[model samples]
Target: MFSFYNGFKKFAFAMDPETAHHQSINLLKRFPLVLSEVFRNENLGGRYGVQVGNLHWDFPIGLAAGLDKNAEAIDFFTRINFGAVEVGTVTPLAQEGNPRPRLFRYVEEESLRNMMGFNNEGAEAVRTNIIDSNRNGKVLGVNLGKNKLTPQENAKDDYHTLYGTFAPLADYLVINLSSPNTPGLRDLQQKDTLLELLSELDALRLAFPKPLYLKIAPDLSFEDIPDIVDVVKEKKLEGIIATNTTIMPERGAGGISGRLLTEKAALVRNKVLECVRETPEIQVIGVGGVSTFNELWDFWKAGGKAMQLYTSFIYKGPKVLDEIKHGIDSVMAQNDLKSVQEILDNINHISKP
Candidate 1:
C-alpha cells in the first residue's frame, strides 16, 4: 500500500495541487464501490470505537472540512475508514473561490498553503447531494461558511441558513470562521463578534438541535481562547476545532497547514482545553499537524475528543487513518486502557498535579 501511495503521490504531485485534488475526488466519485472496498479497514469496527456527543465513531480519526466542499464524494470517503467525514465550508451561494494558483505545496516541508476562499456548490446543492446519498452510514458533518460577497456583519445569517438546512441531515455541524482564504472571515472569531454570532445561532439551534463546533485559527493568541471558551459555555455549544491554519504573510498570501502548523495547532488546542477543563461537556477537536502516532497521542493528552486530518491525507494517503486507529489501540493496550475515554481519563488525572 505504501509503495502504491508513493507512486500515486508522484503522479498526483506532478500536476497542480488543486487539479490533483479534483482528479482524486473525481476518481473516488467514479469508482466509489471499488475504491471503498480497497481502502476499507476490516477491523475498524469494535477495535477502535470512540463516542463524540451523540454519535459513535468507528475510530477517532476523521476527514476535515474543505476536502469535499460540496459533499459530492461522501459515499467514497465515509467507506475509506474515516470515523467521520466533514464536508464543506460551503456558502449560501455557489462560489468560484479565488483565481488560479491558489494552492501551493511546500514539498520539502510537507506543508500546504491555500487561498481557496471557500468554493463550493452552495448550501442547497450540497445538502441535496448528501441527502440523495443518505450519507451511506457515514458520520457526516457540514462546515458552514458565509458567502464571500456577504459582509462580515451579516455572516451569522449564512451560518444560520446552513445550520437550518444541514443540521437535520448531518451528525454534527461546524461553524467555520477561520479559513484565511476568506477576507474578514477570521474576524468572526473575535470575542465580541463571536459571542454575538454564536449567541444568536445558539437560540435558533434550540429549534433544531445538533452538535455545533467552532473552528478557529491557529494564529489566535493564547489570550484569545478563554473568551472563545466563555462563548462556548454561554452558548452551550458542543466544542471547538483548533484550528484552521496559520497565517504566514512572509510566505506570501494564504494559510500554511501540515507540518508547519504542528506546534501552533497543539498550542491552541491545549489552550482551549485548559480553558474548558472544568466544562467537560465542551470538547476540543484537535486538528492540524496530526500525521504521526505520537502527535495523535499528544493530541489525546491535550484533551482532544477527536482529531481531523487534511494535509497529512494529501501527503501520506488513505492508509494513515488505519495507522492512527491501530496506534491508538496499541497505546491503550500498553496503558491497560480499554477505550478512548479511558485514555482521556488517565491524561486528565495526570494533568491535575
Candidate 2:
C-alpha cells in the first residue's frame, strides 16, 4: 500500500503542489470508511490521551491546520488515526487565498513551501462542517484568523466573531497569528498585541469556554518565547501549539517544512518548556518537522506534552503514524518507562532547571 502511495506521491510531485494536494484530498474523501478502519486497527493512538480544559484527546499526534481548510474531509482524516484534526485558518469571510502557484515542493529538502493565505470557505461554512462531523469521535480544533483584506486593527473582531460561532462545535480553538501567508498576521504576535488579543480571547473563553491554544511560528527568536509564555500564563490559556511554518528560510519566500525544521522546533519547544517550567500545568503541542519516531521522542524529551505532524504525513504516507507509535512504545518499554506520561515526567525531571 505504501509503495503504491509513494508512487502516487511521486506522480503528484510532477504536477503543481497545490493541485496535487486537492487531488489527494478528494481521493481520500472518496474512501472514508475504509481509511478509518485501517487507521483504527493500526492502533496509532499517541502515548497518552490528554485533556485540555473540556476536551479529551485520545493521542498527542494530530493533523495540523491547512490540510483541510474548509473542513471538507474531517471524516476522511479522522478515519486515518489522528488524535485530533485542526481544521482551517478560516476567516470571518471567505475569499480566494492567493495567486496561482502559491504552493511549491522542495523535494531535495524534503520540504513543502506555501503562502496559502488563509484560504477557506469562511467561518460559517466551517462551523456547519464541524457540527456535521459529530459522527467521528476524533477531537476537533478550529484554527481562526482574519481575512486577507481585513486590516490588522480589525483582526481581533474577526477572531472574536469566529470564536463565537465555532466555539460550540470545537473541542479546541487555535488562534492562528503566525501564518506568513497572511500579511500582518505575525504582527499580532508582538507582545502588546498578543496580550490584547489573548485577553479578549480569554474573556470569550470564560463566557463560552473551550480549550484555546495559540499557534506560533518557528521563525521567532528565543527571546520572543518568554513573551508568549507570559501571555499564556497571564490569560490562563489552555496550551500552545509551538509552531506554524517558518518564513526565515535562506532559500525562499514560502514557509519551509519537513526535516529542516526538526532541530529548530526542538529548540523552541525546549525554550517554551523552560519559560513555563514553574507552571507545568500549561500544555505545549510540539510541531514542525517531526518525520520519525526519534524526532517525536526528542520533542517529548524536550517537554512537549503533545505533538503534531504535517510534512511527515506528506513524505512518509499514512503508515507513519503506526511506525511512530510502535517505535516509541518499544523505546519506552526498553527504558522501563511504564507510560508515555511517566516517560515525559522523567524527561522533565532531567531537563528542567
Candidate 3:
C-alpha cells in the first residue's frame, strides 16, 4: 500500500495541489468500494473505539474538514478507516473561495497553506450529499461557517440556520469561526462575540439538538483560552476543536497548517485542556499539526480524546494511521491494557511512545 501510494503521490504531486485534490474527489465521487477497500484498516475494531460527546468514533483520528468540502466522497473517506469524517466549512450558499494559487505546499516541511475562504456547495446541495452518503457507522460531522458575504451581526443567524439543517443529518456538528481566509471570521472568536453567537443558538439547539463544538485558531491569545472555555461552559457546548489553521504572515497570505502549526497548536491545546481540566464533559478535539503517535501520547497525557488530521494524511497517507495503531498496541501490550479506554484510564502509567 505504501509503495502504491508513493507511486500515486508521484503522479498526484506532479499536478497543481488543488487540481489534484479535485481529481481525487472526483474519482471518489464515483463510489468505488474496491478502491476504498484497498486502504481499509481491517484491524480497527471495538477495542479502538473512543467516545466524543454523544458520538462514538471507531478510532481516534478523523478526516478534518476541507478535504471534502462538499461531502462529495463520504463513502471513500469512511471506508478508508478514519474513525470519523468531517465535511465542510459549509455555508448557506455556494462560493468559489479565493483565486488561483490559493493552495501552496511546503514539500520539505510537510506543511500546507490555504487561503480557501470556506468555499463549498452551500447547504441544500451539501444536505443532499449528506443524505446520499454511506457513513459506514463511523461518525460524520458537518463543520458550519457563515457565508463570506454574511454580515458579522447576522453570523448567528447563519449558524442557526446551519444547525437546524445539519443537526438531524450529522452525528456531530462544528461551528467553524476560526478559518483565517474569511474576512473578520476570527473576530467571532472573541469572548463576548463567541458567547453571543452560541447563546443565540440556544433556542435552535433546544429544538434540534446535536453534539456541538467550536473550532478555534492557534493564533489566539493564550490568556483568553479560559474565557473561551467559560463560553463553552456557559453555552453547554460538547467541546472545542483546538485549532483551525493559523496565520503566518511571513510565509505570505493564508493560514499555515501541518508541521508549521504543530508547536503553536500544541501550546493552545495544552492551554485549553488545562482550562477544561475540572470540567471533563467539555472535551477538546485536537487538530492541526498533529501527525505522530508521540504527539497523540502527549495529548492523552494532557486529557485530550479524539483528534483530527488533514495535512499529515496528505503527506503520509493511510500508513500514518497504521503507525498510530501500532503505537497504541505497543503501549497496550507493555501495560496489559486491552482497550483505548483502558489506556486512557491508565495513560500516565502506560509506556510513552
Candidate 4:
C-alpha cells in the first residue's frame, strides 16, 4: 500500500499542491468508512500509549493541524496508527484564505511553504462534522485560530468562541495564535498580548476544564522563549506544541515547514522543555520538521513527550506514522528504556538546574 502511495505521490505532486490536497480529501470523504476499515490496526497502539494532561493518547505521533483543516478526515485518520489526529485551524467565520498560489513544495528540501491564511469552513461546521462522524474512540485535537478579519484586540473573543464550540467534542484544544500567514496574528505571541489571551482563556477554562495547548512559531528569538514557557506554566496549561512553522527568506516566502525546520524546532522544543521541566503539568508536544527516527530522537532528547507531523505526511504518506512509532520503540529497546516516557524522564532529571 505504501509503495502504491509512494508512486501516486509523484503523480500528486505534478498537480497544484492545493488541488492535490483536495483531490486526496475528496477520495477519503467519498469512501471514509471503507478506508477506515481497510487501514484499521487494532494492535498498533497499546504499547505506545501515553497520558498527557487529562487525555491518554494511543501513541506519541499525531497528525498535526493544517492537513485536515475542516475535520473532513477525522474518521479515516483516527482509524489509522496515529496516537492522535488534530483537525482545524478552524476560525469563528470561514474565509477564502490568502490566494490561489498559496501552497508550494520544494521537492529537494522536502519542505512546504504555505501562507494559507486559516482557510476552513468555520468552527460550527467543523464541530458538526466531528459530532456526525465516527470518531473511532481515538484522541481528537481541535486546533483553533481566529478569523482573519477579526481585530487584534478582539482576538481573545474569537478564541473564546472557538474554545466553547470545540471543547465539548475535543480531547484537547489548541490556541493557534502563531500561524505566520494571518496578518498580525504572531503579534499575539508578544509577551503582554500573549499573557492577556492566556489569562482570558484560563479563566474561561475554569467553566469547562480541558487540556489547552498553545502552538508557537520556530522563528522566535531565544530571548522570547522563556516568557512563552512562563505563560504556559503560569496559566496551568496542559501542553505546548513546540512550534508551528518558520518564516525564513532562504526557504522562500510564507511559513516554511519540513526539513528546513528540523534544527530550529529541536532548539525551540528543548528550550521550552528545559524551562517547564520542573512543572510536570505542562507537557511538550513537539512539532515542526520531524519525519524520521533521528529527528524523533532529537525531540525526545529535548524532553518532548509527544510529537506532531504536517509536511512530512505530504511527502512520506501515512506510513510515516508507523515508521516513526516503530523507530521510537526500537530506539527505546536499544537504550533499555521501557517507553518514550523513560527517555523524557531522564532528560527532565538530567536537565534540572
Best by lDDT: 3
TM-score of each: 0.95, 0.92, 0.98, 0.93
Question: What are the Cα lDDT values of the candidates?
Answer: 0.85, 0.79, 0.89, 0.83
lDDT at 148, model 3: 89
What is the TM-score of candidate 1? 0.95
Clashing pairs in 3: none
Give lDDT for model 3.
0.89
Error of 3 at 139 (Å): 0.6
Better candidate by lDDT, 2 or 3: 3
Candidate 4 residue pairs in clash (backbone atoms < 3 Å): none
Write model 2 residue lDDT over 1-353, tens digit each, in one string: 66666787789888788888998777766777775554443654454665544666676588888898988789888876677888898999998988877887777777888878887889888888777764368888889999989888888888899999988888888998989888888989999999987776666788898878888998888898898889888888887897888875576676877777777877887788788778877888888888777776677676566788888888777777777777667766667775666766677553211
> On residues 180-262, what C-alpha lDDT tens digit does candidate 3 reach at each position?
99999999999999989999999889988888999999999988888899999999999999988998899989999999999
Candidates sorted by TM-score, best first: 3, 1, 4, 2
**Model 3, C-alpha of 339: deviation from truth (Å):** 1.0
- Candidate 4 stretches greater than 4 Å from native: 36-42, 332-353
* lDDT, ranked from best to worst: 3, 1, 4, 2
Question: RMSD to native for every prediction?
Answer: 2.4, 2.8, 1.0, 3.0
Deviation (Å) of 57 in candidate 4: 1.1
lDDT of 3 at 283: 77
lDDT of 4 by residue, 302-341 (tens): 6566788888888987778767767766766666777666
